[model samples]
Target chain A: MLSIRDLVTSYGNIEALRGISLDAAEGEVTCLLGPNGAGKTTTLFTIAGILTAKSGAVVLNGEDMTRLRAAEVVSRGIALVPENRLVFPRMDVEDNLRAGAYSRRASAAEIAADVADMYRRFPRLEERKDQLAGTLSGGEQQMLAIARGLMARPRILLMDEPSIGLAPMIVAEIFDIIRELNREGVTILLVEQNARMALDVAHKFYLIEGGRITFSGSPGEIEQDEVIQRAYLGSRQG
Target chain B: MIDFIQNTVDGVMFGSSYALLAIGFTIVFGVMRRLNLAFGASIMLGAYMGTWLHVHYQVHVLVVAVTTVACTVLVGIYVERLCFHAVRRDAALASMVSSFVIWMQLEEAAIHLLPERTYAFPGLFAAGSYEAGPFLFRTEQTAMLLLAAVMVGALHLLLHRTRFGLALRATSENPLAAAYMGIHRTWTVLCAFVLMSLAGGVAGFAILATDQQITPFFGLWATFKGLIAMMLGGMGSLPGAILGGLLLGVVEAHALWYLGAEYRDLSAFLLLFAMLVSRPGGLLGQRILSREELAFRRV
Candidate 1:
C-alpha cells in the first residue's frame, strides 16, 4: 500500500536517510530492522512527512504523499505511533484517543463507537480511561499509544520500537496486539531491534544500515542467511 | 477598617481586568512556549481603537467593543505573520526581539493617530455609585468584575469541554504528535493569537473603564503587569495566572495605601523578585524552561 523510492532526508548538514527505498504491501506487517543510528526512525519520519525529504517520493496507493504536511499525511490514512510512545502526558486516556480522531470528520456517534471499540479491545485502558496518560504503567502507556494511533482509523499504522523497554511478558502481549490489529487488516510498518519477534510477525523484512538498505527478503530467506544470523541474531558463527 | 475594606474591594474589581490580561498573555505563552512582547501593544491598540471609534463617530458601546475586538484580532494575525512566524523556529530571543520591534512600531502608530499623549475614554456607563454598608462602589467596577468572571469562565469551558480545546492542549503538549493526529500546527498557533487578541480587547475595555484614560504608555504598563502576574501564578498554569493577578492587585493596593503611591510599582516588582528567588517556577508552575528550552533549542 506504501512505496518509498530513493528517499533522502537530512538534519542540517547530516543526512540521515540516503537514497533508501522499500515497499509495504497492503495488509502485511513490514518490518525494518537496523542497529542504532541506522536511520530506521528517520525513514519512518520521512515517510510520515514529519521531516522533509531532500530527495525521493513516498507514494500511498499511487498518490505521492512526499510533499504533504504531516497532518495532511494523516488525512490520507497513515498513522504513526511514534518513537518512545509520545502520548500526550497531561491529557487523560480518553482525551488522547479523541485527539487521534482529530483528522477525521466522522460523526460523533462513529467516534464514540470507535472509542468504545478501543476500550473493549484494551480493557486495561478502559479501566484507566479517566487517569492521566503519564500516570499509567509503561505497558498501559504503550497500549494507550497504539490505541491513540488506531483512533485515527487509518488504513496504515506505523509503529516504532513498540516493545523497547517493556517486560518480556508485556512484550509478548504487545506482539499479540500487533497480530490482532493486523488480522483486522490494518497494514503495519513496524520498526524494531528485536529481530526474533520481528521475524516472527513480519511477512517481509528489510535490514538497513548507515542509511541504506543492506538486505531485503522474506523472513524464511533472512533466517537462513549466515551473515544476518551472526550480526542481528548473535549466532556463534556466520 | 473601612478604608482597608474599600481598598481591597477596589483592588479586586481592578484585578479582574489584570486577570483577563494575564490569562490571555499566559495562554499564548503556554501554547507557543514563546514570549509575545507585543501583547502589551495589542492591549494598547485595542483601547485606543475602541476609544477613538466611540469618541469620533459616537458609536454604540457594543459596536465599539465588536470593532475593537475584530481590529485587534486582525492586528494580532498581522503581528504573528510579521514578527512571530519567521522567528518561530529560530530561537525565543529572536521572536522576543522581533515582537519588541513590532511593539515599538505599534506605539508609534498610536502616537501618530492620536497627537495627544492621552485620550479620555468616554465612560461606558452612567455616573452612578452604590453603597453597601460603609463601602461605596462604582457601578462600572461591578460590571467590570462580572465581565471578567464571565470571560474567564467561558474560556475555561472552551479549554476543557470542547474538541478545539483538546487539539489545543495536544498541540501545546507536543506539536509534532498533534500534527500526526491531523491538527494543523500553524492553524493552532493562529487560533491562539486570535483567542488572546479577543481577551486583550475585553481587558483593554475594562482597563479603560476603570482608569478613564488611555495612553500610549499604557501598553508597556499593561505588558509589565501581565507578565508579572503570569509569572507570579506560574508560567503554564491557568488558574495560577488568575490568582496571581488578583494577588498582585491586592498587594499593590495595600502597598499604595500604607506606603504611599511611590511603592505601588515597587511592590509589584518586589513580589515578582520574591517569587523568583523563593520559587523560580512560580506558585503553580510545574517546571521552568531550562536554558536550552528557553533559548528555543529544545522546543
Candidate 2:
C-alpha cells in the first residue's frame, strides 16, 4: 500500500500539487486522471523522489519515503515507469531491461531469469531483444519501459502517461497489459490522459485538476457522477 | 624514401603520447559535455606531484605515477562535488566555468610551485639509440611508445569490459536517463575526471622520460595535439581519436623531416583544419541526443 498525505510540490514558484492526499491499495489498479497541467506527473515525481515536495509525507509500505533520492527510492522497492518511456537510446533492448534491475539485490542469474520471464510475457521484446531501444516503435518502447519497471521487482509500480503518444490500437494494447499486470498481482498506480480507457482498467479513480484532486471514488461510481462527466469529457450536451 | 620512412617511424612513436592525451580529453567531453580547458593544468599538476615525489623522496617511477594520478582524481572529484555539481543543473555554463576556475587556480599554483622551471624525472630506459638499418631509435622514445600503447589498451578494456566503464559510456550518452536508472551521476563524472587525470599522470612520466623537462607550461602541446586529434577523429568516437592522433603525428614528422622543422606547428594545424572541413564531427563523434529519446517538452 502507498499513502500520500498533504503533499505539496512546486517547480520554482509554480505550484504543481497543492496539499493533495491519496492512497493506492495493494494489487489494485489505481489510475489518476486529469487534463494537461493537472499535477499528475508531479505527483508521480514526488513519490518516486525525483521531485521533492514542499511539505508532505509519502508513506510506502509503512515507511516514510518523502525525502529519499530517486535512486534511494528505487532501492526501497519503488520503480517508476516515467512518462514518454525514457529508455536509453543507444542501449540494446536486453540491456535496457537489465538497467531496470539496477537497484535490485538479486544475483545476475536471478536477474537474467526475471528478464527471461519478461521476454516470455512480452514476446515482441524478445523478438527485438538485441535491437536498440531508441529505434523501437513508440508502442514497443512503452512496453519495454513497463517490462523494465517489472525487472526492478518493485513492491509498487508507478507508471506515468504510458499511453500518451500511442495510436488507439497501441493504447488498447497498453491498457490490456496494465489489466493483465493487475490481475497477476502487481500493485499499480498509473497516471493517464485517456479518461475512458484509464477508468475501464483502474479499480479506484482520482480526478486531479489545477494541482488538487477534485474527486476520488470507485470507477463505476465516479463515471456516473455529473462532475466526473464534465471534468473528464467536458460535458457539451446540446 | 629513407627520410620519409624515418619520419614515419618517429611520428608513430611520438603520436602514442598524443593519442593518450586525446583519449583523456575526449572521454571527459563525451560524458560531461564540457570542454576541460584546465585539463592541461591537471596534467601539469600531476607532473609536478610525480616529479616532486621522485626528486625529494626517491620514490620509484611507477609509485610516483600511481600516487600522482590518485591525487589528481581526488582533486577532480572534489571539484565535481563542490564546483561542477552545483552548476550541473544549469547545463550551459556551469561545467565550463568549473573547468575554467580550476584551470586558473592550477595555473597560479603551478607557477608558485615550479615557476616555469623544467626538471626531469629519471628516465626508465637507458640513454642510447638502437640502430635499425641506418636509422637509430632512441630507447626512451621506444619506452614511451610502449607505455602509451599500454594506456590505450588498458582504457579500451576498461570501457568495454567493466561495469564502471559501461556506466561511464551510458552517462556520456545521456545523464538524466542514467540517473533515473540509478546510475550515480557524480560517480560517472568523477570516473571521467579520474581517467583523464590518470592520462595526466602518465603524460607527466612520458614527458619526463621523453624529454629532459618538467615545467608548468609543458602540457600546452599535449592539449593542442590531443584536441586537434579529437577534432580530426570526431569528438565522441574513441577509435577516431586514436587514428587522429597518429595522423597528426605523421604530418608533423613529415614536416619536420622534409618541409623544414619550422613548419611543424603549421603542418599539425593543417591536418586538423582539413579534418574539420572534411569531417566536422571528427571520425567518431556522436551528434546530440535525439529529442524523442530525451523526451523533450517545451516549457
Worst ten in a row by lDDT for model 1 chain B? B83-92
What fraction of native interface contacts is shared by candidate 1?
A: 0.92
Off by over 4 Å in 2: A230-238, B1-10, B57-59, B86-88, B128-142, B288-299
Worst 10 residues of 2 chain B by lDDT: B74-83
Candidate 1 segments whose C-alpha is farther than 4 A from its true place: A236-238, B1-6, B289-299
Q: Write the per-residue lDDT of candidate 1 for residues A1-238, one digit (tens) a residue.
A: 8999999999999999889989999999999999999999999888888899999999999999999988889989999998888899888999999999998877878989999999999999999999999899888999999999999988899999999989989998999999998998989999999888888789999999999999999999998999899889886766
What local lDDT score does residue A188 receive in model 2, on the 0 to 100 scale? 97
- Give the distance in Å from residue B118's predicted Cα in candidate 1 to where it truly belongs: 1.3
TM-score of each: 0.94, 0.90
Clash pairs detected, candidate 2: B119-B214, B233-B282, B233-B283, B234-B282, B234-B283, B236-B285
Instruction: Report the Cα lDDT for residue A88, model 2.
Output: 78
